[model samples]
Target: MVDADQTFVIVGGGLAGAKAAETLRAEGFSGRVILICDERDHPYERPPLSKGYLLGKEERDSVFVHEPAWYAQNDVELHLGQTVDRIDRTAKTVRFGDDGTLVHYDKLLLATGAEPRRLDIPGTDLAGVHHLRRLAHAERLKGVLGALGRDNGHIVIAGAGWIGLEVAAAARTYGAEVTVIGTRPTPLHSVLGPELGNVFGELHREHGVRFSFGTRLTEIVGQDGMVLAVRTDDGEEHPAHAVLAAIGAAPRTGLAEASGLEIADRAYGGGIVVDERLRTSDPDIHAAGDVASFPFALFGTRIRVDHWANALNSGPAAARAMLGKEVTYDRVPYFFTDQYDLGMEYSGWAPPGSYDEVVIRGDAGKREFIAFWVKEGRVLAGMNVNVWDVTEPIQNLIRSAAPVDLEALADPHVPLESLVA
Candidate 1:
């Protein structure tokens, strides 16, 4: 029943690809759709891998986005465990792995996401050092941590970012002595600013986690093919059993680059430059998710967000563009982190060292607080710790760019909901 002339080839079978395919079908586009994925399984949810799955709170199947039957029912041709080698724009074909399979398409989308960054330092290749990026990685880490048996074993996290901090909390809960070594002066200081970042740092410290702040990990020492200690830039060594390198992620643009797509220079700053509609340098090809650096309306610049909100939203937006109904991707960037019975939610985006003011609502010492970063009286970004419900209102304030009265914003008596309207 689908049109032959309307074939769509989407590369990368993660959230973006899966969601885009579903969105296209939901939009009543009866076209030949082929999804090419490097992984040999159904598209799965990745967020839970760090918390629920890693902690054995959830099953493996619970993390998947779609089941086998759902793909068959929707008429989505899924080519899993296959790698797309390169794209031929002139011939409108994509050459894939081993069998050298080539798929032709009228429209192409590159949702090629990012991979976990590893520590280039020595002993990183040790048997006990792990990076949690996939389900298998989480399962292996859980196995290793469980085998350590709640003793004097230490888990060294190389970064203080969300992933690293989340794992640190998880490691502590699992009865492992967790030591966090962050390059920043404070935990998440780059994103939350020094003020709020210090609050998070204090929270972790109060929970009995050791933090080596403003220290660079130069080398990881190993014993018997396993991590034993991490050497810092300050020339000090910290003892450890397991090492988790969660520094950050790099955009997996190898395929794109091989296909001759213009690679944006991230050194001078800014991510991959896609337009408002998420089109890459080649108009025939498109990209979304962590790999695609698209313009955000709230932030007023091109950003590559490694968050669930952006991954889910950008896919559908790219699908609209493929269908000729272009929509600007201008949503307020939002993210949350759950660690040791505490929930932290962040809304919108603000440049580092750029906020004019930070107004706190609630008690930072109690770890139940809302901090708003105001630039020119407008709420550019904000973070809510133990205040999950504040996310909506604060996000609305960011979207509206509404001026917040300092006194009212700082008052706990004035509901955050009052700011939205």
Candidate 2:
């Protein structure tokens, strides 16, 4: 039984924090709910930041999780633009940066999220260099992209992950010369494997995007304190009006560390360690979203997923756990990405070097396919590219863990449901 009068303080005002607050209210917890956000805006979805929002296809209001009126209606307190300085577990209080207000909580949820990884290379502090982790960053980059539409601008993107690739597509759509620099031989090689990665590389190449693969960015050259060009280890200088560093993101766990919560080691991506129920070492404190590295029952390993779906689902799971409800965060991990005309939806966990074989079901050249990663004759993970309305079957196959007929799985004529049946 939850103490209805106890206060619940949720840190980090991203999708996870918003969803947790919603869950608490939906679960009939008439308690004091306070959401602390470092950003000025309320919680909003981030997927559109790189795609629709950057491309000017979507409006600003559509990205928000809830309008201002929803908070007032639900009786949820919003403390925006306030950074949590420290967490004193002994006092059950969290110190804020703005005016140094110390707020107490009977239960706390840390959704501090992650920050964009910054490069130590030269000229990174220059005016036109950008990193897109927040809406503010996206807004700044959107301005640069707008300039590209009017002028003959060149954008040099560092790293070949999802953000870098999506931005490359968006910049190309706006008639900018895009150059992507990556350490891997192919973009997203580690996650999607080289075969599927080459397909994306081909997609970008078709749109006139250049790739300097298997190279490192040594410096970002600037003129008048604004980005002008980038120097790669291959001794080549690529001229650019803007630079985007999308190498990766590091989990924001300083408060969790200061409060003596158990954190995963570097091997597990250095996030807050949580159990199946999303409870940290201290039962009073819980974690969710990108910050929580919890045990994944299906994969038999601890993993932290940094994607929209995880943040959306884990928030409620953590909230339920906090209320002493019997729950298990066992949802299959899912993520999706859109680039140019290509859209992909992937589900289940197939960690690098874990899958034994990959079976493709459609033509990679046509950019329509479903790829499955199998281990020990069981379907571990599956990805559908440019295919719609089949995620349910793919997820069902993964959950069943049944041995599949390779011929039937590869045949487009066979309905995915029949294979599982």
Count of steric clashes across candidates, in order = 0, 0
- Model 1 lDDT at residue 279: 88
Tens digits of per-residue lDDT, candidate 2, 1-421, equal 3355789999999999999999999998888899999999889989999999989999988999988899879988889898998988889999997788899999999999999999999899899889998999988899898898679799999999899999999999888999999999899877887757888999999999999999989999987898889999999999999999999989999999988889999787789999999999988999999899989777788888889999999999999999999989988889999998999999998766888888899987898999999888778989999989999999999888778898888899999999884
Off by over 4 Å in 1: 267-271
RMSD of 2: 1.7
lDDT at 371, model 1: 87
Worst 10-residue lDDT window, candidate 2: 1-10
In angstroms, the error of model 1 at 240 is: 1.5
How many clashes in candidate 1? 0
Winning model by lDDT:
2
Off by over 4 Å in 2: 1-4
Question: Residue 218, candidate 2: how far off, in angstroms?
Answer: 0.7
**Ten contiguous residues with the weakest lDDT in model 1:** 264-273
